[model samples]
Target: MVEDPHALFDAWLHEAEAGEPNDPNAVALATADAAGRPSVRMVLLKGHDERGFVFYTNRESRKGEELAANRHASLLFHWKSLRRQVRIEGPVSPVSDAESDAYFASRSRASQLGAVASDQSRPLDSRETFEERYAAADARFPDVVPRPAHWGGYRVSPERIEFWEDRPGRLHHRRLFVAEGDGWREGMLYP
Candidate 1:
């Protein structure tokens, strides 16, 4: 009787952290514009709780633009080592400025510098140009690099969550949780 998707997600995430060889927090983020043209890319899950799944990005990036145009988004977490996947659909909202600042502060100096230097989804004339920009940013912030204004996080407030686990003979297990008021209603789906 797992009524709370967060609890289930936590359990699976812990398992993934132990079993996955690489980034356990990696997730495929899907976003679409108002016209329904969908796009997806990989991003690291920075945080999660009852509030929803959180990931940071450049607000000027393609995904960020799409999120702004249409707040609806979806996240998929797949741990091939465990043969488990979780799908979450929800509306995304910007995290508090304080939250973004805190996370930015926690990041490595190089990462912070890179965030400031990189133009994200924008085109680059050459790698050297990008590196030069990064070098300038690096020189600008020799210490205590501040988070760029365009860099922040988004939280997907889930309306529905589905958990899938592989089973023998292709008889997989699937459970779905739909938000209901302050709680959730769980149901099993045929797999």
Candidate 2:
């Protein structure tokens, strides 16, 4: 058995990345706003380590504000080609400022500009308006654009992680790891 749940998670993710045709790193991120209403959207997993799973977004965006108000979040990683999935729930925290800067620098110039231009989850008058905003940002920063102060990464330190693998006859294999006081407890469940 993998001593750490994260090790197992890495192995499974690697397999999914190799076998899936597209967007293998995509996951559904779920967050709840101040009113306790939940929202979910597909976001790319940029990095993962012992600290937890990492993703980036605008600090003022809907998900960002939700996470700020309620530090709890969950993620679902589905690989339909392999009929497997992984779910993680945890407390969210902003990744180190240095980490965020490095990742931001690695993004394409156009994407960096797009991030600066987008008021994610906010109403936009039209696609043209959005494109015009992007154009303006591009013009404003004709060189290497600095990462927006309001954009960065968050790390979700999971307290629970579950893995599901499909089997024949509608049966399935399910394993879960729940964080205890210091470590984690692993158990299997009925499919």
Candidate 3:
């Protein structure tokens, strides 16, 4: 077994991607604003490594604003197909512009346009208003759309992670790794 839980997580994620029938990279990200009010919603996992987990969003969005105010965050991945789940809590930071640009360029043309068109987490009058802006964006950038300044990515460097698996009895298996001052401390938990 790999000594580092982060490395083990990467391995498990890879396995889940291969084994799961759908949205293997989907994760529920949780963040709190300055007021300590928490919010969570599902987002796709863009990248992961020793540094952290990466996901993209509009800088002006509520989640983005919250992350900016407080860099702490948590994440959860539930794989029903494998009856397994992983939870992570960590510090958040913006990804490099180069990274954001690369990911934005890889997205579909319409998605690129939508990123520019939508004022994410902002109030809108109607669907017509939204579609009108979307159409305008499409017309404005008929080719080679540039990534919006407001759109980018965030990476969470985990301080703790928990892995859970279902067992025959009600006693599910649970393992957790906590970040110590310079390294990680691992332990098992009763389910």
Candidate 4:
């Protein structure tokens, strides 16, 4: 009976942050190519708000390419310890370059160098080659590492959000919220 799905998600995520042992912000992101081929991968939730959920990645990566071809996507957040999960589906758009640059600047130096060195989904000849590339990047940017032009963040503007909570005797509580105009229409589902 929550009026705002974003508020409910914030509360659930707060509880998860306190209880989850690792990566409480981790979420499964699902995307599809222009041909309708689907792919799913785990990514950290960099930010979230009424606008939608946000995550960053290399723009040339497989997921990125897929996102470019198909803007619609889905996100799944499962908190095993709490026996709860949330599903989000929506259209996505890229975040501003300023946002991407700020986030990149906040990352550790090593991570910055790694991102610069990586070809992401592309095949690599060997580990040593990657190490060499990483070393070169580190040497090239001894001070500030600039975010690559191909690296950025994307925001998913949710059209539907579903929350599920576990209960006794195989019963569960499922609530769904669909965006309606500027507000949300809440409903229940059998689970």
Candidate 5:
């Protein structure tokens, strides 16, 4: 019976951070193309707030292209250790360049070079070609690696949020929160 879905999500995320052995912020992002073909992939959740959840990727990546065509997506966060999960559906929008720049700057130097070298979602003849490209990027930017123009972040403004917790005897607790005018309308879902 939580009034704030964001707050509940934050609390659950905190618990996951403490309990989950690996990437606690990892989430499955689902997207579709203009023709409604669906695709799902795992991405690290970079940030979250009342506005929405954020993640960064190459704008030319498969997921990014799908997002551009559809402009809406769903996210699923499952914490096996906690036997809990969160589902989010929302419209997607690009984050500001400033935000993307800041996050890009925080990444390791090697990662920065990889981001620049990769022509994500594009065909590559061989691994050596990619290695060469990466090497070139490394040599070109010995000091500061600038974030590529095609690399950026997207925010998903949630329209619906659902929380599920496992219980005994095949029973489970499921709560759904739909965005209302300025708040949320909470309800229960059979599980």
Candidate 6:
């Protein structure tokens, strides 16, 4: 009986980093509106620990809005080279403003400007307009770009996590971890 899901995730992620050619940290974040309509998009996993999986985005963006409406969310990670994927379902919550600001400060200057310029998930008139706005932001903040109030991070506090590994002949392995009393209860599920 595996005890710690985070430890297992870390081990698999380390292996995926070595095998996956592209973004090993990429995960599909799934959220729903108040009406329960679902939407999924790729987001880079910024940080992960026992607390939750965290990713930063503009609060006005579609996912952020959806998360605001529906606290529950899901995440999926597929690593083709490693023939593995993980599914996570949990309630989501916003990270502290300090955390978001620190992460934003760690970003490249161009990225900071772009974050300020981008009205993420909103329609843009033209690429030129976006570039203009981006340039304006860059000019406005010649030294340091402050993190926009809408730009921040959210953490999904996992209630359930399942790890899957593909195998030949369609036979696969599935290990599920469900949060229990002060710990996790592991179960093997059919694939």
After the best TM-score superposition of candidate 2, give how far the Cα of residue 61 lies from its true spot, in angstroms: 0.8
Q: What tens digits encode model 3's per-residue C-alpha lDDT throughout 31-114?
A: 999999999999999999888899999989999999989999999999988899999998999999999999999999999999
lDDT per residue as tens, model 5, 1-191: 44799999999999999999999999999999999999999999999999999999999999999998999999999999999999999999999999999999999998899999999989999999999999999999999999999999999999999999999986999999999999899999998
Q: State the lDDT at 118 in candidate 6.
A: 98
Query: In terms of TM-score, how similar is model 2 to the real structure?
Result: 0.96
Candidate 4's C-alpha lDDT?
0.96
Estimate the TM-score for candidate 1. 0.98
User: Per-prediction count of colliding residue pairs?
Assistant: 0, 0, 0, 0, 0, 0
Q: Candidate 6, residues 56-100: lDDT per residue as tens digits?
A: 999999998999899999999999988999999999999999999
| Top candidate (lDDT) | 5
Q: Each model's TM-score, in the order given?
A: 0.98, 0.96, 0.95, 0.98, 0.98, 0.98
Compose the digit string of candidate 1's lDDT tens values, residues 1-191.
54578988999999999999999999999999879999999999999999999999999999999999999999999999999999999999999999999999999888998899999999999999989999999889887899999999999999999999999999999999999898999999999
Give per-residue lDDT, candidate 6, residue 59: 92
Candidate 4 residues 45-161, lDDT tens each?
999999999999999999999999999999999999999999999999999999999999999999899899999999999999999999999999999999999999999999999
How high is the lDDT of residue 191 in model 2? 97
TM-score-wise, the better of 2 and 6 is 6
Q: What is the lDDT of residue 18 in candidate 5?
A: 100
Better of 1 and 3 by lDDT: 1
143 Cα displacement, candidate 4 (Å)? 0.3
Stretches off by above 4 angstroms in model 6 are: none
